[model samples]
Target: MNAQAFPPIPFLDLKAQQARLPGLKARLDAVLAHGQYILGPEVHELEAKLAGFCGAAHCVSVSSGTDALQIALMAEGIGRGDAVFLPAFTYTATAEVPLLLGATPVFVDVDPRTFQMDLASLEARIATVKKAGALRPRAIIGVDLFGQPADWAGIATIAAREGLFTLDDCAQSFGAAQGGVRLGKAADATATSFFPSKPLGAYGDGGALFTQSAERAALYRSLRTHGEGTTRYEVLRTGMNGRLDTMQAAVLLAKLEVFEAELARREEIARIYDAALKDVLAVPARMPGSQSAWAVYCVTLPDEATREAAKAALAAASIGHAVYYPRALHQQPAYQPSHDGAALPVAESLGARVLALPIHPDLSDEQAQRVAATLIQALGG
Candidate 1:
């Protein structure tokens, strides 16, 4: 069969989303007409809508997902000599934020199947930190890797016992739920992204912080705008310029109208892949009592060589595939010194073999089945 017979698949079909959002142009036009670009009405509107969507008391919009994490940490005064524990098998942003704030990130191993922070590893790493007596265990950043909620109950219990602050990195899992509740209130402070690829993405770079406390909400507001006391010019404390733009907020507002249906579609596609590909490879494991946003659908190949073979097959079939993180954060050159030779076997192994298939709301069932068949053929399974 000619490879051209199969249509080229997109890893993320933002254009299809744009086509669905008819109000997109109207929203942009309203932004232009109002001309209150910075911290405009749309920004406030978006913040309120986002907070309500996940039952959070407050949602402070920021420049990006990284900014959301930074603002949340800054509010807690997590600086030098502080230790921030997080999973090693995630995006670089999660680990890099702590180092940027003069804190050390203790990389913990993730669950081999679920791809979430391993609670056992987390407890052991905290003990290791205490034994070293060098850094203070101040915060634990539980990342909801790939759209599934982390073990927030376990993480919360650990944080309570150890006297550490908890931060939820919900960048890819904003719409996800745990224990019948949405993710915004799962941690002490929840940070999520609205990057163009996120489940609830904006047109451009954007993010928000969610918290149930009014005090923290107020602090986040002040911190995002140069830590102002009352007026914009009066700086009460040091803070970064991390305000979300009106245009992005307008775009998000439009997208939010269809966000629920999109999330449902993503889950349906994930199920289709699950049923079709389980026998061929290690499919993504569903978390108990949880509903994921299904931001990514990653499967494990038998080995690194098999992954390469699958990649070649996917390309030949005109299908899109990607590796979430080709290298664990601890294995990265910049973080090697901080890692200090700490072994994270699960993370290291996932780096070499895991592969992400094309998963988006616009992906059809036929396309999903095609993806599975191609991978199965490639792996000779």
Candidate 2:
């Protein structure tokens, strides 16, 4: 069949998901009826469910994924003169949080195949920071890029040796797992987003932190609500108003009912793309002994020219496509001044050539096939 035979495909079909969620309206109505739009019962309920789903001991809900990272770092006393390490290929939020917290971000290269932080690069970067002696080597944030788990086992070993705190930036990978266990318990602390496009997203901006420590959980709860002590008015320390909205929590709870099934659908769609497109383009490489949430199914072209050509072709075909990150964190203008002069070839190359195709629970088989065929044609197959 020709590409013109298929109708336009939405990058993410939230309405389709809403239609499948039978209790969505009731959940929203409950929030309205309760009249507790702030940190209400629904918020706690969602937090519990989220924690349980990931097999984590505690889940602290926050206003956004950025706030989750901030609160986690705050609890660890990360500030000026502290060196925070993260991958250069991930979203800005992972790097932004460190800079916003008055810390320096030591960007590291990523693996060409997995698009994950390179453990060797991470070790070398840590050594570079230690040798510099100007900044304290404080933490390592291993991002689960594109909904796939990072090498947590390798990251943990490095962190243990370097005596650095390990923060799992699981914003794109909450539902994912590593070594048969869910992602939440892989690091010292894990942060995840609930943006509408995420696998387990809320209606609006919301996020959460997961941990196995009761002490860290208590600190997170306090930090999220203005650092309160035993009493609400008694201030224990400086904090931010990062509470998740009750309405958003209500929405998440409704969505959570269908999350498992939706994840399965996403995996199915990803498999379809893998089988169809692998021969033509560089498909995403899954982590060993792990399952991804399949947030964004991206493919890498041979070079920048090939990507531009593909982009033009996809646009002409009316296919929904996007570049996840056009620039690595080190190349972005905001971080250029702070970025140490290091050539991260893999991250830079990925930023230039990668393009994401539509992959969601609502995408049909015909649409998936059309996407693959259109992309292959665009690549001049």
With a 3 Å backbone cut-off (N, CA, C), the pairs that clash in candidate 1 are: none
Misplaced by over 4 Å in model 2 are 1-4
TM-score for candidate 2: 0.98
TM-scores for candidates 1 onward, in order: 0.99, 0.98
Relative to the true structure, how large is the alpha-carbon lDDT of every model? 0.93, 0.92
Model 1, 2: alpha-carbon shift in Å? 3.6
Clashing pairs in 2: none
Q: Cα RMSD to native, each candidate?
A: 0.8, 1.0
